[model samples]
Target: MDALSRAGPRARRAAAAPGPGPSPLPWGRFAAWIDCVCVVTFDLELGQAMELVYPHDFRLTEKEKTSICYLSFPDSYSGGLGDTQFSFRLRQSGGPRTSPFQDDGRYNREAPLTLQREAAHYFGYVYFRQVKDSSMRRGYFQKSLVLVSRLPYVNLFQSLLQLIAPEYFDKLEPCLEAVCNEIDQWPPPVPGQTLNLPVMGVVIQVRIPSRVDKPGSSPVKQFNQENLLPAPLVLPSVHELDLFRCFQPVLIHIQMLWELMLLGEPMVVMAPSPTVSSEMVLALTSVLAPLRYCCDFRPYFTIHDSEFKEYTTRTQAPPNIVVGVTNPFFIKTLQHWPHILRVGELRMSGDLPKQVKVKKLAKLKTLDTKPGIYTSYKTFLHKDKSLIKRLLKGIQRKRPSEVQSALLRRHLLELTQSFIIPLEHYIASLMPLQRAITPWKNPPQIRPFCQEDFMKTLEHAGPQLTCVLKGDWLGLYRRFFKSPNFDGWFRQRHREMTHKLEALHLEAICEADIVAWMKDKSEVEIVDLVLKLREKLVRARCQHVPVREETLQRVGLYIDTIIGSLPEDLQAVLHHP
Candidate 1:
């Protein structure tokens, strides 16, 4: 499912698109919080600040909702509706919202609770009942007329006040002056407007609607939200809200109402098929772009309910999506690409105003095929079981469910975030090891030498140890003596590696070994050779000093136990027959 859409209701119960990520937001949070809470309880720190996360016994009760009064300004008595309403009363039942959207609950009254009391500090957060279940979302939410005790918040106050109660504007001047003058801020307040709060910054805006910024009296404005005037909020596929719709005024403001999850970066599509919905593709593209990620399916693409979320939560790949065969095979932008699975799907049962609904959406059948679905799918499975095994290897290595789809784009999934940083860190780690161990491949660019470097290093080391530097480096002298059979195996493998590396060498022979032969090495060559030597020696040394039958017997005795000591993932390889 798309990350934005994952915030909706139905996506909760639906299994994630086959092997993509976890369930939608609430579920994902619930799972994580479960583990967190378990630890808190175990540690007897339930009173810790973090323990307030969805704890039990503290949610709303239904009776409290029936007697409360909701706030809404009419043309008769108001120019703008401010945050404080001096009104109260009403009651109803208690329940949690199925989705993460604001204002989802069974309540009869709009809680007139003060931001000062329930949540005092300007930015201090509190999850109090606005009614029974109404509140804001994960992203930045800004109201123009939210009353503030501080002067700096005055212009903001007027802007949103107008949105809530336009008729009350004449009264807004004194409020704006009192506050703005105190802060010595702004060119005063404007009427009939909503503020654009892209990432928490706010600005005063006029009621007129325009897509581009037209310069307001205020100097600061949120990115993508500048010049946006107050208007009926528009979203895409309300269930899969087009979160960007609010900023895309006049372009068919939509509430997507569709669950379209994106990874961290924009997915650069490589497939040939393109029958998928352009809007869906655009939506997913938008999500993945800013987040920096990629995808497997196309737009309006249905993914297995179970597999859907795997794409968003940075989870492991589903068996089929990774292998290139989707269910219905809806041809997409880049082959039968994996789509932002519908992590959520919802249909309203109670009466709802038409102002909130749009009729352009539809449910999609998964384009990825399932087991026993077709010949190609089975063929794909058979051919890539090893690939699947490899793909799953990491997941198994750590927590099987640790794989995360992303809240951003696939490329920028938080799991993959430090990609460059980790690579840099890894390179840095290897620098010292390479300098100390490798006297041949210097300034090691291990990437290019991945395959052939070690083989050559081993081959060179063998000849030097056994044939050339047969002194202190000599096996027998240095306690390197081994069983004949083990020696033969080691020698043979070394020779093969040496031959392959020699064949792969693009330049002059890197034969100048620091131990036996020197002065013929490049920084690159030295680094490469050292890394190769380290791999063989360290792994071998860590486990066995001599490659003899006795060693195997002793080591093999602890094989299962040793592998078990390793991660569940790596154990798979050790356990494999």
Candidate 2:
């Protein structure tokens, strides 16, 4: 019976359902004939399947043939039924077949039948025979089917014929054999080898499809064919497709390896010789390009023996993985052992504050003198030192190359010359005056700076005052100063402090109260006060100021006025130089 008719009650139920269902025949019959039938279905396109099975040697007997079939018979029946067995085959039946016998088969002594519907129009057959004398009455069926459809095969063949003459197959055979031989000759990866290098030749094979159809003519015709005359039908073998498939896993593995390289771990690549091909270098660069902007220390690639030694000896270095490529051409050109490595360097110079002081500034009248000036200098010095220390520590932790170390050192030196040295000099200039100034606890009976006390005070300030002369008045100096502009920076600071000192000195000299006190004093006392005033002016002048001659003359005239009012003898004595 045909598959749909044999489906019986199950087929009617399936047909009544709303959507497509499993073929009723296959589902029901699978259980009855499960022991004997092994049905294999090929999901491949019909033309491809036929090409694989029939190839060029075998030709179809007829163009109208639509199906290929297979059949098998059971050797024995179960339950001592005396060798009664069932058989079945698939054929191109035009319409459904049915039996006139009753469903139970008791009246006609007929065999049991089952059908499995496959693709839309195909069906698999199973037949069963009852064991006449056995206690178990169920029949056994054995069947095998190989069905090849005609539509797709005919279409594919017709297209092929239009594209090229049949003689193409004869010319293609040797090329196919050559490709298969090449694939067979490729060495399998070494067992347990940590680095499996890619074979460039195999990689080249995958490019065949793209290169197949060139501009003027096809690539197939270019292949060496010495004895046979060239013809358009003589195409290159399809075995190249197989070779491409064989290399697919290697390509995938290489891609994965590229991802791992992005982790920025240290890597060592072993080459069979001292130098690598330009192609290999290009490949390596492409793999590493993703990490070009990374801020961390870059992975190293080098061919130098010393570098390899350094990498091995440095315990603090990142773990190194060995990389190798399978191409013997590359291998022979690369270094043998302790291979070349490439190391990456930091690309970003970290952002640093333009001003050294990170902290907020306190309000102050002037940085020209006293504690305000001294404190500002000290604060900036400490901030710069801290910044330098932090940067150095980061460099050490990152383990930068020697070139990077030198660059950082140069930067630090520039910072010192620009900001630190001038600050130190300014602080030194202010220290003595800062220490000498003291507040009085009680009013003194006599002026604090008479000639006697004045010389003593001057003696106390002498050593520190000398320091001003010894230091660079033009500004702080360096042996090999790169910044001539630093001289201007220093001079501007000194000029501000000198101006403050000049103002203070002039104010004391012009004080009305100081003149009144001089008038009341004895000639000797007046002379002594004048000397003290002169000493204060000298101190101010020493601080890089050009003390005004007019101011000095004015102070002398006031002392002369006091002397003019004194007795001639006293005046003469006071005028004694």
Candidate 3:
């Protein structure tokens, strides 16, 4: 009979039950099983095998080396095998037993037929097995494999599908295939070329449990924001202590100094969240310490804070540049100087008036009227009886202050018309005669009647004859008629005024002179002249009551005219002030 018929009902049921023969073990998992068999063969030869394997109910003796010649049944065998029923045999060899056998109650099985064919092609006579307990409940084996191969240090990696959860792998195959196919279509790497691998580029997401003050308190809320974490953290309910024990040797082998020395390049370790625990940071640092001289060993962390909140508000204003000049020269010449130099205004620095002999006048002081002229005029008008009666009638229904102001304005207008106007007209008549008189050779003498007439008009205006008139019309009359050196003073003042007018006329004509002089003068002289022209223009602009735009444009044209005749280089310098 075949092995199935001899094994009773269970073997018959296993052969008839399945839709497929456990599908095929994934390539990686089958290779891992072969590797386990190879290790067992080596260990049993040295009496270091961790599992007791008795062939025909005989314990392996010291110095009697046995090996895993084959781990799977022949193709002719037709029964579903149990976990402990491996097809290994003992072999007698001449070797001193160094290590004692350790029975760890573990066994191995052959891999599926698909993996056996691949193994045979790559490594001659290789065998694979799945280690499991004696009962083999529900056909669930440990996440470990064994392999027997003649090749040295050759390991086979098991696919995660067979080792962990086959159902999950079956479900995820479509998605995984799509991802893998996309990756396969990418451009191939050049031959003999090493890629510049990124140092650390993994993001691990950890979800912190909410803090509560007491039992049954509401759980802390999680932010409903995106990009909170790259990957979800999975916390399993049941703890399997030996779950990772199978990989412990592999981890130790990778981290060993001898293994690292064999590699031409140093290894780098990247962990998530260096801030989480100090021990993890220290451990990573110590592992890379040996390769510090040959490689840049850096450990990076990717942490996302759950409590962090970000907000964007308004921006701050820019800084201001404040330029101040001490003792400015243009303060003396410029009219309406305060207004011209008003803060935040756009006046140029050169247009500022000079701080010379001309005193800085307040806005009120610079007005045409003398100090307290309006007040004195109002007081004088109030004392006049005729003016008072007329003002009372005119402002019968007005407020007291308004009535007073109206009366004062009326009296001032009457004075200006009757007294000031006649005086100005009489002075205007004398200007022609005065101009005709030569001061030195034909100094004209004033008649006694003309002098008496002027005095009579001044005396007739009673209280109106105050300091404003005294400093203005009255002052001029006194200076011309009363002073002993009247002619000398008048002539001197007149000469100064004429000289100023003449200077202005000369300055205007100099533009033409500059054009003429440019032909004969050197570049230095021409440059000096241009500079002087600019200074005069600036000064003229400053002297005006409120510097006129037309005056500035005229001066600017004069400058342009002079500069246009100069050489290109010199013209550029003189083009602007």
Candidate 4:
């Protein structure tokens, strides 16, 4: 049966468009947080199908519908009957990818290019369940409740699904409507602040750490939370996204993984289930903390994905993107990928979780090889035996998993910082002297960053000189320079430096006597000067440049006063807005 026809009347009514009359409460305001709620189920004939999507008008393309269905039901059922939850990310099919600062020529279009570029993707949190029954076809019933959103609140969204999905499977229509209404009341996801989001009577407390803050540090505040069940003081981590838990199994080979991630190498993670597969892929992207991972990645990839043909073709080299897959079929299909990490299922039989063994393979095997990290890539940094010994000792003592995760996370964070600190020092040195900058001509261009020159600095000042962990630092830097992450980092710094120069020039102009400068000039020249100053003001407001608001305000007053003194026709042209 077609999905809509199979849905009950209540389901249809809840999702239907508003009838022609008084307009319904605006949903577009909340669209930034939650896009739509959807119900997907397995079809006897059509395979995975989208049965219902709330706000029926929030449409999905055919390709999107198929992808969502496949991702929502990540694993094919054999005879199981249990509920599983996970999250995945996909390219946003519909939405404005424009900058949040976009307005009617008020903000500079080129200021927030990174934010606009990154807005092209969105996230999905899924709660899937299955039950066995002789009365149903195939002896089972299976379905999934999914929340499609742009924010990456893994802990918050998964908790929301846990509260709603079970009730949804039991009561159906009422549960869907209730959840949709609750979501409609949620506030916009403003970063850098703690937000108490209520869904289906549960207040989920979380904070999406701001990029402006220091990595790994987000302040916590007590809230008078009320719910059917007591909520956590704060989610264990709304910032880290449970990255440490995902990397726990493969903790031993983390340095090797970090190297590969930094170099933006094409790797495939093969896991026993979609939950593990997706988490592993997402965690890999954040290994180079504080520096963004610019390469593309798919948390859960299947043979049915739209890019399957492009990702699997042997005719060309694999794209520089991380691909996570659950099917053994990918073992043979993606065998040509440079790096492959095969993760084993969770082993809960022991008091303490045993670290999975890692083995490097000479040839890629379709089914015979065991679970381990399989790659020929050599690691430049030496393994930290001291840290490994402590971890192993903690395992021997049967330390709690939470303690183990924290220990690992701290070590990785320090390792990344050690690598980044030296670069920051060198980049700071490249900045030109403030005295050399003049108000007359454009500020002199900053010196170009050099790889060899940077390498030469290692003898006197490098990560190894300060950090306890040692490595062939030169070798690592060489590989890093060739990666997409390096390109992104360099470009961001270049933009910052360029903006700094512009800001200095602006400050100089603001301090000068603008009225005296334009005293002898014609009306046309005065109008041109005002326009240039206004453009600079807009750019300063839009970009994260070092410029005081007082300077900008003074420049604005100068423009207004200068325009007031002009002839009537010219003044009207200046004040057209």
Candidate 5:
């Protein structure tokens, strides 16, 4: 099949941009959410393969194609098979130096520069379908329909796929064309605003929360009370931050999981399907939200992934990453990983799924173990059984899914914030007093973090103080200091504090009477001071040290004024630039 040459110009143009920029197609709108639509089929000769990329002419590097193929289909996908849906991420190596989506005016356009520098990843939503086919060699036809996007709106994408995939599987290319055309009509994602996305005759209303908005504050559109509609308007439950759905079965061990996430411990999640594996991984990564996870994570990993060897190697300690896989091979391959959570298929038992009990295994027994958490790390904090009980009771009372999800979200958010509060307070104390600053000398360095001293303060100000949940937070903090997560958090806080001090120093220098200082020095000395000030300004701008705009302009005016008063040769040398 000539897959590459089948698409027309519009399809090619829509999927062209790798990151976030305007599509060349004459659709006078930003490339909304869907980046590209792909159809991956299992080929008898080539194994997992891409049957067609909707934008057939859109070029994918061989490496990219390999990644898409493996991630789209589950490995060791045998036994009882039905349709399954999951998500994956792909890290692109390069993009525009500046924010590419600035013109798009989306709230999430400003991606973190540091994370972007490391590797800017995008999301892939895959719907895998298998059907009995006697004509096929494998006795089944297995394929996946994928939608790529820079945004991580899992629910919206999944909903889109529900409408598109089944039709596309039956009708083929023509269905994809109709879907893409429908997507073209979608309004650009505005932060904190409800979006009514109409796709294939269905209006899916959703709110994409802004980073500034508190978690779970996203409002749902309301239907008029006077209109006695035959059917009730029900908003889809948001799963983007749905930690409850993933952890409900294993809620008793969530404290330990939170600690592991905080320490950036390497873990492997084994599940029965790609959907469960991906959801669990995504949920675990967000266990310590508000404080970035600062480590690598893959939702649905496969044996054929590029980093498969890097992740599975037993030569040394495992890298800080959370790998989710369905293939039984990982059970043995990732046995050496510090923590492993093996979960069974998600069961619908009303309020919660069947609680997956934590088994304190003498050894991982990687060769054989039931579906449960297998980890040696003892949890420092006590489990808040009251919270779980309340949730269960609410479920028993038949609370709506939205209500249950909100309750879970609030509990977790508070839990995370309570843990982080003491750290924030202590870090604030480390900053140097403003009175200690001197115009003639350098800014004072921040006091180093003392673990023992900070631990002592926890008695009064720890998470237990403000939060209903109680724990041996002191022990958690002591262990935390030795973790990569603490180091990353400390370094980030330290750098930000250091930047503030430097900005203060620059302001002090700018405010000093440079004109008077020049009076006391020889011509050469005056020239040297002028040059140093200029260099400092350039350095501050380049480093993004957050100096005030007015301060920068004032320094520039001073430099020009000082240089004008210098000897003609000195003035010419300074003005040459």
Candidate 6:
């Protein structure tokens, strides 16, 4: 038979995981095909074998090595006694066996066989089938085909290992074997059993000595000390970050890892989450820890943060491992944080790293803005200062003194004074970070978040004035058009859009600076400047969104022209100057 005919389908051992055999290869396959047993084998390459799962620490002892498998042979290898040019040989249980191809031409040729084995404490069992050739040919009687037991896909590696002699396997076909002196069982269950629990674990770093929170546990290195800076510190490896960027959202995969590694067995992880550099701690400790197996222990962070949470709920992960980060200190210093070192057992490193801390920046000065805020054209979006103050005061009334620390009191005061405080202020530190992204009535006072709302709220902002110039937009226009993530099968356009918007914001800030400089000037100068700026604003906004710059510019110029076409600013009865 040619090489193509020699290849066979994978074999799931009927002896170990016994189930009704697959119905005879549908109607297309004929009786003649079952006469020749061609055992197609896939031997596991050294590295590839690591992927096959086994109990933890299964290879600790040499005598404990019982069964090993490399190929999944189809059931067609049971018969076909033939006198071909070569003999059939294979490495099986106990030892190797070599025999000539049989030419019996009868007696059921194929034996839908699998190259799998079992073990107890010590002994191993393997099955090697070699049919003796009955053909009257003289020398052809001793030829054989050897089967290597392992997974398929070894074509490349096997070529490199050609120098290594191939072994012929033989089946033990043992009797009721019993363990004696930790070495007797010939055929029994493997060393480990499947687990049925949660798989949340920690990769200990800086192993918090048992002495922590005690007299002299030892202090972790802090950056505050001037003279102690060490050699160039590498960026905290974001190895786990890839998990958050996978197809499965990071959180779901994390919970799944808990289920697979810590839960029941005879199962496998088919889909993992996409990975993200920012979510490293969450990926390893919480996401992939449960997927670890003693037989095949490979740790990978494939889950993406964007999709991870779609699969999890309250009970999916441990309640203690909050998915969100609410710590104000952590939020303020997000960029400076190093690799997230798992602080506790729960995968809650989304907050801050172990050594890093958020230091509150002292307020330089608070600008009093009662009159400007109340009278601003965009006054509608601004909350009533009195109402905000009253609400915060009410919250403060019942809280413990500690909860209302000086910092908290100051922040609450800012809220009361009609200032939009960041939503992070309201959240508890232990809570997840996702809450900040959620929509709420009070609304988060985050920077670009507020700006996003302000732009959309035309009526509330009351004739919002904008000053933009083509020159103000340098890299922004180039970036938006250069982005390839939009049309070519985009998986995450939302994030891209956000990035584009942020680029545009810098343009707004530059425009604001130019307009701020001309706030006070000659009427005619201001009017022309306003017209030009309005033209730019309209153009910029229309370029990105649906609105047109021509239309808004025309409207702004018409309004300003009409107003400029009016008398002077009738000051409060010309306050005696």
Clash counts for all predictions: 139, 17, 24, 0, 0, 85
User: How displaced is residue 508 in candidate 6, in Å?
Assistant: 72
* Cα TM-score of candidate 1: 0.18
Which segments of model 5 are wrong by more than 4 Å?
Answer: 1-36, 54-59, 79-82, 90-120, 133-140, 174-208, 215-241, 347-353, 362-368, 435-442, 502-514, 536-548
Give one digit per residue, the lDDT tens place, for model 4 in 439-484: 5456788888988888888888888765787778889999899889
Name model 4 segments beyond 4 Å from true.
1-25, 94-118, 225-233, 239-244, 347-361, 519-527, 542-548, 564-577
Clashes of 6: 85
Local error of candidate 2 at residue 379 (angstroms)? 22
Candidate 4 to native Cα RMSD, angstroms:
6.0
Question: What is the overall TM-score of model 5 with all chains considered together?
Answer: 0.81
Model 5 lDDT per residue over 1-577, tens place = 3654577645654554233455445443324565567889999999888888755545466777789999999778765567889998876533523322233332433332111212267678999999898999989989999987666677778877888898888999987877776666566666655666566666666665555555546455544434423333234532354666677778767778888998888989998888899999988887676677777788888988888889888898999888889988887788878788999876656545677766664555655567888777878788888878877887678776657667776777788788888999999999989778765566898998998888888878888777876667777777878887888888988987888887887888777887677776788877776777788788778666768988888888888888878889878888885
Candidate 1, 544: how far from true, in Å?
48
Model 3 steric clash total: 24
Cα lDDT computed for each candidate against the true fold: 0.25, 0.30, 0.29, 0.74, 0.74, 0.24
Off by over 4 Å in 6: 1-60, 63-243, 246-267, 271-577
Residue-wise C-alpha lDDT for candidate 2, range 1-577, written one tens digit per residue: 7776676443443543332333233222112111111222222233111122211222233211223211111211123322121111122344443221112321111110011111122222212122242332233222222212211111121222232212222344443333322222222211111111112122211112221122112243233234324322332321111111111112212322332333333333322211121112223323332112121121112222123344344355433333322223322333222223221111223532121111112322222211111011211112234434544455456633333333333333343233334343443444224223221111112112122332344334432343322222222222212232334334544555556545445555555455556555676666666566556556655543445667666666766676677788876776785
How does each model score on TM-score?
0.18, 0.18, 0.20, 0.86, 0.81, 0.15
Candidate 6 residue 19 Cα shift, in angstroms, is 59
**Which candidate would rank higher by lDDT, 1 or 3?**
3
**Better model by TM-score, 2 or 3?**
3
The candidate maximizing TM-score is 4
- What is candidate 3's lDDT per residue for 1-577, written digit by digit as tens? 8887797443453454322232132222212222222223212233224242211122233332222222221212222332211111122244332111111211111211111122111121222233334555534232212223212111111122122223322343343333222222222111111111110121212122111112112223233226434332221100011111111112212122211211212221211111111112222222321111111111111111111011011132111111111112212222222212111111222422111111123432342312110110111111244543454344344435434443443333343334334444444344334344431122333322266566666655532544232223454344335422233333433443443443343334443454555677787876776676566566554433233456557656766877787788878766653
Candidate 1 residue-wise lDDT, 315-422, digit = tens: 442322222212333223222223322211122233211122121112223343221111111000012133234333433454222131121122222212221222
* Residue 435 lDDT (model 4): 81
